[model samples]
Target: MSIYEKIGGEAAVDAAVDIFYRKVLADDRINEFFDTVDMESQHTKQKAFLTMAFGGPNSYTGKDMREAHKNMKLTEDHFNAVAENLVATLQDLNVGQEEIDAIIAVCLTVKDDVLNV
Candidate 1:
């Protein structure tokens, strides 16, 4: 099955994103990046990105992650924080370890896309 199917689907993606963004918005280190963003819109974009990355039907079609994050000067520290947040969100949502690992593998595949360090 595709990763999307494995992870559930749109509903699951939506839930994961909602939880992830709530944490990100409240996180001091990453909050600055989202301060001026429309939370709903940003959340939608993130959903699209994650869905596409995980083999869902949606097309991401957003700016390249590297370009979108270039100005932020993202580093390993920032990436690790995001990863931790993701793991927590997955656990909170009761996603299985196998599924979570699949999702995380997708994220890891794009490390260069979101980090400069």
Candidate 2:
């Protein structure tokens, strides 16, 4: 089964996105990047992105990571901050470490693109 299904599919993704965004918004290190963002849209995009990333369903039609973040001037610190928030969000939701690791592994695949490296 895909990690998405193993982790409870849509409901899990929804909860994780909500909690993750709250954490990201509260994080001083990365919150500045989202100051002008439309969070509702962000949330929707995130859900679709994660769902696809987790091998659930592919409804993600947003820009590729490199293109999407090319203008953001994101640094390693910013990336790390987001990763930390993701970890914390999963932990808060009682997701198992192995699954969290799997999820993070999926995220890591986009790191270079996200960092525009």
lDDT (Cα atoms) of all candidates against the true structure: 0.79, 0.84
Which residue runs of candidate 2 sit more than 4 Å off their true CA positions?
Answer: 59-63
lDDT of 1 by residue, 1-117 (tens): 986887788888888888888887888877788889888888987787768656789644324776777778787878878878888888998878887788888788778878843
Model 2 worst lDDT run, 10 consecutive residues? 54-63
TM-score of each: 0.86, 0.91
Segments in model 1 whose C-alpha atoms lie over 4 Å from true places: 61-63
Candidate 2 lDDT tens digits, 7-105: 899998888888888899999999988899898898887777667666688744334777888878899899989989989998999989998899888
lDDT of 1: 0.79
Q: After TM-score superposition, what is the CA distance of residue 55 in candidate 1 from its true location, in Å? A: 2.8
